[model samples]
Structure formats: C-alpha cells, structure tokens
Target: MNLTQNRTRIIEVLIGILATQLIVFGLAIYMFNEPTRIVEAQGEILNVQLDDAMTLYAQNCSVCHGLAGEGIGATPALDSDALRTMDYNDLEKVIARGRFNTAMPAWSKEDGGPLSDYQISELVALIQSGDWIETQDRVVNLGLAPLIPFTTDPNPALLAEIGNLPDGATLQAAVQLFAANCVACHGADGLGTGIAPAVNDPLVREKTADELNRTVTLGSPGTLMAGWANVLTTEDINALVTLIQRWDEVPAGILPAPNVPIPVTEESLALGGQLFSQNCSRCHGPEGQGTQRAPALNVKSFLTDTSDLAIQQIVTQGVPGTAMPAWGDRMTESDIQAIVGFVRQWEPTAPEVATPTRGGGGGPPWLRNNTTTTQGTGQQSTTGQGQGQGQGQGQGQAAQTTTQPNWWEIIDWRILLLAIGALSIAFTLIFMGVESLKARARPAPTEDKSQE
Candidate 1:
C-alpha cells in the first residue's frame, strides 16, 4: 500500500511540474507574438511615409538634382558629405528660403514657391538618409572622373602679347587674374570641369565684347559667377575680354565642327541610335530619360528651349563648368549629325508616353511568344516524372513535399536561431523529466545482510 501511494505521489508531482512548464511556454509564445503585431503596425506606417517622400522628391527635385540626388550640369550634388553632415534645421531653412544669388529657388509656399512645410520636411528626411554614399564610393573606386585634364597654362605667345600692358591691368594681367580667380572653377585650359562651363565654347565666343565685359564686371545674378568689379580695374576687364575673344581664332580641329552637313534619313537615324548607345547612354540613360549625370533630352521643356544649331554646337564644343565633353575631334561630322537626328526624334511637341503593349505579356513584347513553349515543356517534365511512380506512392510523396518547410525560405537568421534554441530547450526538459520518472520507478536498493 505504501509503495502504491509513493507511485501516486510521484505521478502527481510530475504532472504539477509539467503544468508549470506548459504555462511558462504558453506565456513566452504570447509575449513573442504580441511584439510582432506592434512591429508590423509600425513598419506599415513607416513604409507609407517613405513612399510619399520619394514621390514628392521625384516630382519636384529630380530634374536638375538627378533622380537620386546626383547633380547634373551646373547643379551641385545634394548627396555629398556637405549635405549629409548638415543639421536638420539648417537644411530645412535652406530648402524653405533658397540660397541668394544662386539657381536654387525658394521651395516654401510662404516664399511664393510650391512646397508646403511638411513637404520640405519630407525632402529633408530623404536627403539625410545618405543612401547615395555607397554609390558615390563605388564611382570613386571606378575612377569615373575624366582622364583628360581641363586646366593648363595659357599659350606663351598669348602671354607675351600682354607684356606691354600696365601692372595689375586686366588684359596684360589676364593670365594671372584667371589663374588666381577662375582656375578653381574653370580649369587651367578653359575646358569645363565639374564646377564650371568651358569659356572656350563657341556659344561663349558669340557673346559681344561689351556683353562679356558687363558679365565680368557685374557677375551673373542667378549663378555662382561673382563680379570682379570690386577686385579688378576697368583696364583689367577690357584686357580679360580681349583674351577671351582670342578663343574664337582657335582652329576647328582644336574645337572641331562638322565640315559637311549630313541630311536626316532613316539610315542616319539607325546609325545615330547605334552611336548614342555607345557614346551617350552612360550619362543620359538608355532611353534619354536623364540621370544624375545628365539632363533628360526627351522632355518637352528641353526640346522647346534648344535649337538644332545649339545642339550641334554643344555636341561639338561641349558645355563648360559641366561634365559635357567635346566630341568634335573624336567623332566625324556625319556621326555627330546622325546622333543629333536620333535625339531630334524625341523633340515632338506631344508628351512622350511609353509605347502601349498589344497584349498582356509578362515579359517584353519580343519574348511573349516563348512563354507558351516554356509552360508546355514544364508540364511535360512534370507528367513524365509522375508516370514513373505508383499513384499511391506519388500522392504520398507529393503530400510530404508540400508539407515540408524549406529552410532556405527563412531570410532572417535571428528567427531561425530562436526556433532552434526553443526546440533544444524543450527536448532537454522532456529528457530530464523522463529520466526523473524512470529513476523513481526503479526498485530501491536492498540491504546486503550476508556481506555485513
């Protein structure tokens, strides 16, 4: 009777211990499940906010600043270290007020611009994300900067011509003045660098001497160009103008142009497409949609503002103070004309829309016909495998395969580790409980009277 009572007591104790463990396991599961709900809710809110911010940036900021805040033409990169380290309040202030004497216009509605305070805040958040830093690092590692140096010393003969001028006078002192003041932006050779446009461009040469003098004296109001009136004398200004005019005399080979005009034709367009793909697609995007490095060619505003002659000149001479490189020496006039013709095809007044698809194809139009063949082959392979197995066995195998969880589908390492740890703990607890029960069920040691 006592032995039976002991067994009953042991069974009750095991049951109680198991109940406690089950309660603890239930509590842990509840706690883990609750936090996931909270986290999911938070994630949804954050995703919505981020999406709105991205849309706003695309609409308003992506033109000159680039779709990814990479700068193009005269614009400075917004993703640079300067912007990354800027304080939120300062960034907001700049966005709202706009910089004085620069191309950046006030964005705040209070300043007669389009954006609200909230929109500006969103933009600030996007800028602060520093997502472009990795891309910039990669670009630097690749050495994407032009190999040809833009800045070089002025010709000795040109320098000698101004020797007779007075000290500190603009013409006589042009080289020294430019070296000190302009070299930072314009490069030593007057080829445009990242900071400034090339002064040696033919478009610049078209400016009258007086217009050039005024520009030098007063500075361009909405640009980085600062007036030198306060620093240089009137004679210095005249000398500088004369020096700039000398660029007009530079030979066509030095700044090449088309010796003969190529007429627009279907053949020209095909050649142009090939040339643009090879030479222009890197900066301009494959579809001329524009990138962080170049402005969109297909946009209505660009087409309206630019003339064919202007485009030709730009292609031949290149823009100064920007990344545009002169292709005159590198490409023939016919080749350049072909590219120009291809670019012109996008210049129609109507808004450019994507070509509509004829049917509901998952891939590109060219690959639509192959979809049926791919599906048919996959079905045939599945049928062949099924025929090789018995019906019952095949069904059982299919059930097992369907029910089995693929470990590779688990992307988060933390979740996987947690699951493994819980399983181990459960197994250990069960093994310990079973060992305890077994020890209790074993016969007690009998006294050894013979040995005593």
Candidate 2:
C-alpha cells in the first residue's frame, strides 16, 4: 500500500512538472521568434519612413535636387555612391544644421526650421539608402508635379534643320536655347551663378564675334562649362554669340518662368477640397480668402513665391508667434499633402487679396488679453487672465499628445488567445494529475467478510 501511494505521488509530481515544462517551451518558442518579428516590424517601419521621405523630397527638395537626386546644375547629388556610403552621424548633422553659404537649409526645429528631429532622420535614411526610383514612382502616384523638369544641353542630332532666318528670329531662338540649357549653370539672362561665369559681363562683350563663337564651340577647360559644339549647330552657336555680344537688345522678362503646373487629379482635388472645407475653412475661409483670424492663402504673391513643399511645411508646422497652430499631431501626412495639392491649384490664376484689417489687438491671439464681448446691446466687454488660461490649455493639450499610446502598447489578440490556450491546457493537466492522485490515495475496499 505504501509503495502504491509513493508511486501515485511521483506520477502526480511528474504531471505537474510536464505542465510547467509545456509553458516554458511555449515561452522559448516566443523568444526564438522575437528577433524575426522585430526585423519584420523594423522593415515595415523603414518602408513607411522612406515613402514619407520621398513625398517630402518631391514637395520640398526636388526643385533644387533632381527628382531622382541626380542633382540640378549646382546642387550636389544625394543619390551618389559617396553620399550612400557617408557616415550616418555626419549626414544627420548636415541635414540638422545645414552647410554654411549653401542652399541646403537647416531642416531641424532645433535650428529654427520646419522639420522635427525624426523627419530629419527620415531624410538622412533616404539619402543613405540611395533608392530614389521607388520614391519617384510614389510621388507620381500622388499626382504631385516635380517643381522643375530636369534639363540638359540640347543634342544637335535631335535638333531640327536650322534654316537661314532673319536676325530677329535668330536672336529669339538663341534666347530660348540659352534660357533652357545655359541658365542652369549661368544664372538667368547669363548673369551667372557661383559655378558658372557671367556671360553678360564686359569680358564677353569686349570679345570679337569670332572669339565668342570659338568659346561657345570649345568649352572652357577645367570649368563646369562644357562645349556646345556637339550639342548646338553652327547657326545656333552664331545666334548665341550675337545675343551674348548684344545682350542689351534682349527685352525685359523674355525668359520663360520655370513654373510647371501642379499635377493635381480630379480625385485628388475632390478629396482635398472636402478635407479643406472640414479642417481649414474655419480660419482660412472657404476659398482661402483672408479671415479675421488667418491670412489669405489664395493670393498671387503667396502662391507664386511659396513652393508646394514650403506651403506643406507651413501647414504641418504652424507659424510660431502667430494664431496658426501646428497640425502635425492632428493630421496624417497624406491629409496634409492633400491640403497642399488643393492650395496649389490656385497658383496659376490666383488674384491678390486685400489684407484683413486688424482690430486694436496687440500681440498674438493667445498672448493678448482674453476678452468676452456680449452680443448687441451695449457691447459690454470683460477681460480675463489670458496667459494663465492659455498656458493651462496648452499644458492640457500637450498632456493629451504625450499620453497617446504607442504601437507596442496595444495588445495583440492572437498573443492573448495563445496565452489563454496555454493556461487552459496547463490547468487541465494539473486537474487530471490531482484526480489521479486522489484515486490512488483512496483506500481499497475491504474484501467482503459475510461468508466468515
């Protein structure tokens, strides 16, 4: 009897140990898969970041930098092998605090720019990866027009036969050619850029027609200027030489403005319009006309000067020391992009809007005294502590923003279900083990003694 009881107890203990081991095995499996899971999650996040960076690049940086980071006339290429292999920290710093005397503006908010640290990081990642084809495709998919089409020297083989033309027509052709090809390195009207010499200068004017022709035919050595001999015909070269020698003959505003129409789709316009009305109309008016609260967005000057990216930045990161509030937290990147598209539609024919007259209000809306004015009657007004109220409300909003749950914080139902199943199996095994022990512990029934 003692031996049987001992055996039963040992069996029960083994059952309990087996149940515990099952749980341990499940945990071990989970841990084994964790690295793969992390890798997959990271890859997904990188894809999202890259897509966003592409849009950012198209809207903001592509004007100077080519669509595929091929680099404009003077701008350095971001997709080059050198940039791809550059140290991560060095790239990040360059983006955060831009190079001095360079067109690359400091993009980080710490340096008084529109982008946040995370955004700067995304851009850096984009540059280092040097994968711009996918980026370009996405920009196209979004119906965002590249600010400027990439321009190259016109190929002579591709040119139409140059027939003898009147002096005026020849000069006009030369102007068009120069504007298209030379204007990139040499600034508009041959005024020149840092990389290229000024063609409109006195040195060129002093040169004989033959010298001008030779210089244009054979490019200046050890300089960015490449000879147009292979690209332009003799007639074209002669026309250019005449134009350069008599630069004064060209009228003002002859060069075509490098403005391309924003590529907005009907679908995009409809969606953008709907979103704009819902979110932006209250302050910016239905047609982006100036309101008592906000400046008119549909003005010629604003549309003409502000690039789509600039407008996007302004929308995402609100103007400080003003009534405009940052919508980065409240809106998705696509939503902001749509708003930019909608706003950009007004650029072609936008008219000047008169500025709204400011009431006798001092400082920004938040900084000014909070006043409650009664409707009609005597128009009685009362003042309250604006700063304190504003601060409190700001703090509350900040708290809400900070408290938003992270992706990892949310429970996965699959994991929960698995855990529950493991626990149920463990408990069932434990219960079965206890029942076997109880059965083993029960006293064997004494043989019947009725016959004795």
Candidate 3:
C-alpha cells in the first residue's frame, strides 16, 4: 500500500512541476516580446500610422517643407533630428505660429495662422511617420539650439547722429544713449549685425564729427537702418556721438579697440573695455571691426579734435536720423568721461573719411549746414594728417566736430509704406477666401416640400 501511494505521489508532483515550468516560460515570452500578441489583439504599441501620415504630408506639408521634407528658399530644412524629436506639442505650436524674426509663418490657428485643427493634427501625425532615428549624417541638435537674437530695425540717422567726440564726458554720454536704444540690435559692444554696420570699427573712428553727424542725421536709402530725425531731439543727437567714441575702449572680443587709452587717467581703460563689450558689441562688430552695415571707427578725427564744448554738446544731444539715439538720461557725468577716455585710446584705421551726404528735406536750419566744425579753422583734414594727437584746449577737439544732416523724413515714409503693405495683403486674402467659401455654400432652389 505504501509503494503504490509513493509512486502516485511522485507522478503527480512531476506533472505539477512540468505544468508550472511551461506556464512560466510562456509568461516570460509574452512580457518580453509582445509584438505577436498585439498583432493577434488588433492593437499596436506605438501608434505610427505610416500610410495615413505619408498621405497627409504629401497633400499639405510639401508646399513649404518640400515633397521630400526639404526646406525651400527662406525655410529651414526639416531634415534635422532636432526638428524630428522636438516635443509634438512644440512642433504644432511653431507650425501654427509664424516666427516674428523669420519667414516661418504660423501654419496653425493659434498665432493667427491659417491651418485648421484637423490639418494641424494631420501635419503632426504625418511628420511623426517619418523615421525619427537621428542619423549621424546631420549633427545639429535642435534640442540644444538657442533662439536667434532680435534683429535691429534701427534708424540710420540715429547712427550718424553720434558726433565726433572731443571730450571724455561727451563720448560717455553718447555711448550711454546708444546703449539704451541701439545696443539691442547693434550689440551692446557696437559690433554690427547682418543688417547694420559696426559702430566701433577703426574705420569709423577716422570720420570727422561732421561726417559722423551727417551719417546719423540722414538715413541711408537702400540700407536696413531707418531714419530717426523725427524720433530724436537735438540733445539726443549729440549724445549718440559720445557713445560711438566709447567703442574706442571695447576689448578684444567685442571690438578691437585699445579702450581706456593711455592718457585717460580718470577710469582704467580696462574697466571701460569691459563696459564696452557688455554694452556696445550688439551694433559694433566683435573686436571693433564694424559689421555688414555699421560704419567703422578706429579713426583720429573723432576724439583728437581740438574743440570741446561742441563735442560735449553733440554727446548731450542726438542727431536726427539713423539708429544712434539719445543717452542724456541713462548716464552720469563720470561714466561719460570714462567712455570718452576709452575712445581717445583707439587707433584710427583710415587717414581720410568720405564726406557723407546729409539726409532730410528741409526740416531744420541746423541740419542744412554742411561744414565741419572748424574750431574757427577753415582747413579740412586729409587722410595722412596727424589726427590722433589729442588737442588739449578748453573745449577739446569735439568743438570743431562737423554738423550733422537731417534724416528723419525718409524713415517716416518707409514705415508708412510697410504698414500699408501688411494691411493690404492681410485684408485681401481674408476677403477673397470668404467670398469663395460663400459661393460654394449657396444652395440650389429645390421642390423639397413635394418630395413625398
């Protein structure tokens, strides 16, 4: 009886162990690789409907993104992983909202864009269908990219308004004014932007105050800078010149000026250089070489002039046009002095400056004067003359600085034209679309009541 019972127990135990092992094996396979199960269950893990997404993209997204997802003229290429892996919501937002600084217009409704909700969703869905595996072929990581800087739509007259500074105080004042208004685009360092010229370049330094003033007061036609005569005051124009002189002190990174010149005993040119880089590099080229449109400095006529009162006055007041602006409110006297001292240190890049044409169409008597500040002298400086030798009379070389031209009138017209164009296009498209939709919806008269 015991043997029979033992055999039966052994058999049952073996059967139980085998059954358990099979169940565990099955469970492990299911958890580890559930693709087969999903196929059988009529559901998938990742919901990437490749076919539907491809169709949606071909119909709508190819216009700007290109049929192959290639970007067109102003459009950035979407063949980047950064674009691929960006959060879906963020992609949707960017597509819907056109960037203010770029040509990427808002395609979705949130940013006053044109895409509908279904279209927006479909766009997102289609893009996701593409392979998200970031191929090492293109390495620009979109996740780590920074937002592009704000473009300066500065007034050309304002830039020209920066006068030839003879005194440290006047120069400092001008720099301060520029910092408040022009630095955002010109770069606080005076380094130029794609559209604006470098303010602190050695070449610009050679320009006579009159030339500088004329450039500032009159907006250059066909240039990115708008005129500023209407926006600024007489006091404002003088202040801008003082600011440009500050570029003389910009350090190595922002501009290539010596900064805190050897003679400026008030503040160390070292300190001035720091201040220049931080506050002036935006418009001035890095290392002081003016950018695309910015006029260069590194000249002698600006700070080495023999006049003072006039230069200081110029620094105190801003010229009429260009991006140069008034700075009387932001800076203290000591700061202005420091800037002037820094400018006095810079070496000129050119010997002679070309006379700048004055802007404005008969606005003020002051703007009409085309003569350089003579400091009572009638002779104009040649390119080879000793311009940097700091003249030390009461007012300084600034007094002889030249008169600026008028530049505000032209800018006013341009702004008006731009506004008109925007309004015209927006309204026209809206009206046309509305009319077409209305035409489509009109129903034909029918005998519906007698249909029975």
Please give each candidate's TM-score. 0.33, 0.40, 0.25
Give the range of the ten consecutive residues with the poorest summed lDDT in model 1.
384-393
Residue 412 Cα positional deviation in candidate 1, in Å, after optimal superposition: 13
Residue-level lDDT of model 1, residues 357-426, one tens digit each, is 2332232222111111222111111111111211111222323343334544533654555576577557
**What C-alpha lDDT values do all the predictions have?**
0.55, 0.60, 0.42
Taking the candidates one at a time, how many backbone clashes does each contain? 11, 0, 110
Q: Best lDDT goes to which candidate?
A: 2
The 10-residue segment of model 3 with minimum total lDDT is 137-146
Q: Which candidate tops TM-score?
A: 2
Q: Write the per-residue lDDT of candidate 2 for residues 150-267, one digit (tens) a residue.
A: 3434333222222222466676678767866666555545765323567888887999999889877765543334456666789989989988987766553454234444445444
lDDT of 3 by residue, 1-452 (tens): 45445545655554565465556555554453454444433322122233333333433343344435655444466666677688999887776654544434455554444457666665665465443222110011100000112222234343334343345456545555664455433553576432245777788877777676666665443332434454556677766764564566533232111121222332224433544454443444323333443443333465456233233334435445866444444543223333344444554432234222133122222121112221221111110011122121222122122112123522454545545555554554565455455444332222343463
Of 2 and 3, which scores higher on TM-score? 2
Shift of residue 154 alpha carbon in model 1, Å: 28
